[model samples]
Target chain A: MLENKDLLGIKNLSPFEILSIIHTAEKMKLRINNKKLRENTLENYNMVTLFYENSTRTKMSFTMAGKYTGARVTDLGVATSSVNKGESLVDTGVTLDQMGFDIMVIRHSMTGTANLLARNVNASVINAGDGINEHPTQALLDLFTIYEKKKNFKDLKVAIIGDIAHSRVARSNIFGLKKLGAEVVVCGPATLIDKNIECLGAKVTTDLKEALKDADVVMGLRIQLERQKGGLFPDLREYSQIFGVNKDLMKYAKEDAILLHPGPVNRGVELSTDIIDGEQSLINEQVKNGVAVRMAIIDLLIERRKKDEVTNTKWSASESFIQDRWEKRYTG
Target chain B: MAAAKGGFTTICCMPNTNPVVDNEILVEYIKMKAEREAVVNVLPIGSITKGQKGEELSNIGLMAQAGICAISEDGKSVENAGLLKKAMKYASMFNLPVFSHCEDMSLVGGGVMNAGEMAQRIGMKGISADSEEVIVARDIILARSTGVKLHICHISTEGSVQLIREAKLRGEKVTAEVCPHHFSLTDEAVEGYDANTKMNPPLRAKKDVESIKKALKDNIIEIIATDHAPHHIDEKNCEYDKAAFGIVGLETALALGITHLVEEDIISPLELIEKMSTNPAKLLGIDKGSLEVGKVADITIVDPNEEYLIDANSFVSKSKNTPFNGHKVKGKVKYTIVAGKIVVDNGELMD
Candidate 1:
């Protein structure tokens, strides 16, 4: 059973919790392969996808997963909803909770928006993305992809490249991968690297070549071009030349290094175009696994909630029964 | 109700109220309400901006004439430096100090807690201490250029304490205040994502807490003010980021000092009173905070030996949002005397 009511971040999850999600995803992936993924496992329940930020892939993936599980899914359009009418995120969440929504899938541009929603609502909260804080579902899918390829995470060297500071994908991956015994090395331009990234139990480096040496899995983060005016980096040309992943630089890897990127990839900026379509690329597979992982998560959380209700009813009924007996004894 | 219950003889109310004490009428109305209903003296503070919008200046001279003790844009920092300088100049002419909430909004970004290892661990957006320091440095320069009496509110970072110390050394007319939370708690308290731990200039690092205590002891931070903000249940009983910033501090400030500062030998009891009472009274030019033959009697007597758990449910204030709830604390207020009238006698209001 999943012990947590919400999937807020990867940092709070134990190795056991991470493994449970991965193990469940593996079973769900097989069902998808055989066209047996769609089921009535979650009938009569309502799930809402509240995307405060624009997302195409993650939002669609979550909707598909909910539909396949037989749950009533409502995707709240932020621009068209009360959110644009100045309703606070918490108020929107509470309104959904009162409407009997069983789960909330939220994506917001603020770091702690998911954390805030989880506290205010009675329904389970699954964070899609929250500012530069965490994207836990994305990390879980990445983990499932890595585990499918490598079969084990112990002593696996993983290289995370490009904009390390603003990428919530990098932050979640570092925590989840490291918790599962992977040695994470984050390589980027000095300005793009956070000062406290090393304290997250990851090795920080400026040289991409050194980071790729003997790497089992390589992840590239999307470089936000808008950050240039804010002095996050000098320019894209300088960034691509130094940090870009080309075949020539890939020679430092162990000949079996797999490349992963949380797209939409800056084709020539973060990685070479050929590498994205290369035999070693797991980017497409990561997207395919994303659906299965999300199904596993929702299934687990819904099951836990049902069990808790049963336990609560049993205890409360027993208390009433004992009280009734005491009252009858006194009256007689 | 809270100030009196906490054994305070007088309180300087911040300008960030619902209507916002930005005009002369609101300032006068606050004073009138306090006089009619309050057991303790209430000194209303006027806003530096109209509606605290940071766009235009408030009627500072008129509000000063209406008996406002000071002017501030407390909840948010004045983003415009030129406007802040002008406000300080006008405030200086009236001899009213400007209480600045020093913060650079761009630097703070979307951070919810201190930008440090803890923020990294939890994957929360970290508000770097640089955000506070940049504004502290800027406001001090403005104070020096305008020659105004400037007081920095809620000093939370070590960098801020250092800047204030260096500014004082350079003979800038600047003073600073530290909240009890800044001196006692660190950003680690936010690990649980508790709404009570959520406050503006959110709880900083352990080193920052250490620096604040040392600064208080060294007299770099001259006062201890609660910044005692209160919000309704619906406002604070939510997620850390969704919750309003601030804890109800009026009732817990003295107990925190007695427990953390006095018992730990960080400051003597008398020095604690100086920061909490004497220094603040002197800064506001109030004729209280001491026992003198010719002065108005504003005194708080406490049983420093008493130990009790901080129960927010028992607080006189309507808001029960405080991270210090259930915390073991020393000292209990026994009596509060205002103008030689025992308002709070033996922990009960005398009416």
Candidate 2:
């Protein structure tokens, strides 16, 4: 029972909360696979996807999740909505809330837009993605896929390679994995690596091949071309030669190691396209789990919001109990 | 009223106001209003470029004659070097110090916070230390040639401090100020995406914060002006990138100086006053910032031992935008007196 109404980032989520979401997602995935309709827990609830930035994967998945749960879903097209007429995010959120929306799922290029919008609305705000900040649902889905394979976080080694400075995926994964008693290795060039990232309980290395050694999971992040011009790294050819994952580099990892990427994959850039399509690849599985993970988050948030309304408190009793246990384990 | 309530006897108002303080008329209007309504003296800063558009020079000579103390393109840099060089030359003739908000627009394109790990973590655009250093270097070069009394505003980065230090060593007639927020806070403050933490030359990295503190101690930075910008609720209560680039500072300036500098043993108590008061008054050529026997009796008696949580709702300014709102701080202004009149008594404004 997670207390938070908004799933802004894994950094804010407890390990218990992480497990809670993963377990719920597992059930959702099993039901969906068996051709069972999702429980109509969200009937009469309305959800609006307010995307200030373009995204096909996240938007569609969230919409499908809402519709799957028997909720009314609306997509506010950024180009055509009143948002294009210079409406602030808070104004847009307030307007949607006033129109009786029970939840607003937002994706904005500006970091912290979800949290800012959350403060202004009565509805539960879910972050689809914000600038280079956290994408909680994406992290959750990735976590679900990893937990399915590894079964536990104890003694697990997760290596995240490429664009660590600019990848929201890398940040959330590093925070989430570290909290669950796993060792996270963040590998990138010196410029591409964030300074003091090791302080977040991750080991940072410039040598990707060395970092991949004995790792249980390897996650590759897309390198935006604009970052190259900023001199974070050399041209594409040099980046692929240095940091890109290939068949030769796969020999360094564990025999049963899984590869993960939050894509549309940058073929031959972050990874050789063959690896992305290989047996070791969990990229497609990650995508499939995205729907179930989103469904779990939507369900949890809606449940928590309804419970809090009845209790007239920020968090209900059972939520506070699990939150305390998770927090104590995390800190001590 | 806000300045006096914050224990400031005099303030050099920046040029980037609603209708920018460009010409003589606006300068006169500011002087008239301050005289009529303000509890403290207000020195209007005329824009270096007309409308602060960085084009031709504003009416610097005329505005200076109308008692404008300084010429500044405060928020926006005078990007055109030739135009700025000419403005510096003209400003020099009137002995009006040019306060530069040093920034390269190209380098700062759409950046919202200090370019560091925190910005990387949050996924916001980073304004690099080079952004401020580049302009500091350019303006120092210009000031070297033009011989204007150049004052750099809200100096944040270590590189900018080094630039000003070397410039001062060469006696290039350059002086700089550090905001309390810059020396005390870092890019880490932006972790929560609080818009109150957002300001122009945004809160810098830890190294930069350390450098700013060191610079102030060594007198490389002469003053600690707030660059106190006030914005309405709507302007700041938005996304990190969309919020206005400023924080209200006058109210918190003295406490921050005492807390971070004096209490931390980085600088002595008298040095804090020199940076906050004595030197600022001297640089502006004002008859304030002192309480000599025959002086105007403008003074602020601070408790220095009082500790309180900073609540923005208690701010005398109409705007409640401040990152320090919940910060526990020492040193409260017990009373503020100006021209032998107590404007702020016992931490409350005198009606």
Candidate 3:
């Protein structure tokens, strides 16, 4: 049993809590894949997405699972809303909290803004995205994907490839995979990758082929094009040549190894079109698992927080369940 | 040290800390510490930027009221151009001299020691002498424009010495300090990678060392600051690459000055007092570092002829990270009088 706290970033979690989230995410992902609804554990919980930034995939995927698990969802996408230009994010977080929102999912452009809101807002604030900082749920799904597909963390070599500098995906994956005992290697050009990851206890290299060579899982990093104005990379095409992991680079992986990408893939830039659509890629499973994992997180945080999960003798699986009481019409 | 207010004194502080002071809570911490631990009147040097992260400027009105000696971005240069000019204007309102670290970190990024033939031998990264001169030249011009009292710290190279000399010749309100290591020890001292030999604006080439000596001798330079950086032993007991730079200098400074300048004929002992005590106090607008009556009797008593090996175990600082650990040196601080209290007496600190 873990305390129900909004996990907006890795800084929000103690080492044990991260491991607990990953373990819970693993169980939820396994049961979903096995089609054995052990007990609709999460019931009658509501998680709101108060996204100031547009998020089509994350909103849709999490919404599906929220329905499956009997939770009400409120979404504010850019097309139907007026938040982009005028509203201050701090005011938006306060308004959502005032509206009896259980947990608010927020995405913003400022780094550390989510954590800042989490301090002020009464609701458990989940960071959907914060400019170049971290996306915890993505990292959770990333860990869950590896846990399910690889089955044994100690036996995996996950290589994070592409846009090593601008990708928060690689940063999150490095922390996620390393914690799970997967031998992780980050490979890209010097300009694209983080220079001080060695400080984080991860080996960083510029030779892409050398890193992909014995990888059990090759995760492609995304080139966030908007980061050009932020001066993250000098040029896109120049970035693709020196470090991009194309199909030829994919041949270096283990025979049973899988390819992974937290998408909006760059096609031929970071990953070859064949490799992204290839037999080895688990890109779709990653998106699918993101829902179950986030649901598990919301259930644990919102519903279970009031239930005293940490001090409870046992998790009761039923006392804090959100899946059983979730409205059937929401799912249908 | 004098009991309440009597005797000769030397040196001033430049405040640059972990959570640099810009508000009352911060300056008051320094004030409280100075009141309790310091015998002399403690004058806090408020940072130009609040928290001194070099982004936002601080309110000089509140800082001037806090009894700050001057305004500075002490250990780091004011990297921003427009902000610095504005800071100069604010500091001018309170008449605070803007002190600076003067090194451009981007240019001096990998600088591990003083760049010269010796750095080439030791295989350590060196901060080139040009790094200091270039920034000094820029600040001199900025001072001319903003007319801020620009002070250069730990001036080490011949190029910088000549520049400051020329700037003074042109009558710019620019003053500079040379460290004992800069004039006394050359780049050769870092050959064995004695971490004590390591410093920011690192050490210099022998010719550069001679130039700094000449500057100090000719009064082309105004002060001899120890740049008294203190650190713990755990920070220095490793490879030169690993050990933290900066010697625990507060207690060892006068000894080094006595040995290097007094004996070497580069500077007389009285000239040492004027530069270390009088000139710095006047420059920073501090009223305590002197021996005149009605002055806060903050004074240092010295046995200028005493000879001893530099040992760090006797130092009063919480940190043992000093480069002058085992060098032989002459003279010692016999007593340090703060205001009127005998803070240090007969080489023993009096509580």
Q: Model 2, chain B: what is the TM-score?
A: 0.98
* Residue B317 error, candidate 2, Å: 1.9
Lowest lDDT sum, 10 consecutive residues, model 3 chain A, at: A321-330
lDDT of 2 by residue, A220-267 (tens): 998889998987677999999999999889879998999999988899
Q: What is the lDDT of residue B102 in candidate 2?
A: 87
Task: Give RMSD (Å) of candidate 1 vs. truth.
Answer: 5.4
DockQ of each: 0.34, 0.35, 0.01
Q: Which candidate ranks first by lDDT, i.e. highest?
A: 1
Query: Model 3, clash count?
Result: 18
At residue A203, give the lDDT of candidate 1: 97
lDDT of 2 by residue, B20-114 (tens): 88899998999899899999888888998877887778889999999999999988788999999999899999999999998998888689998
Model 1: clashing residue pairs? Answer: none
The true-versus-predicted C-alpha distance at residue A314 of model 1, in Å, is 10
- The local distance difference test score of each candidate is 0.87, 0.86, 0.70
| lDDT at A234, model 1 | 89
lDDT of 2: 0.86
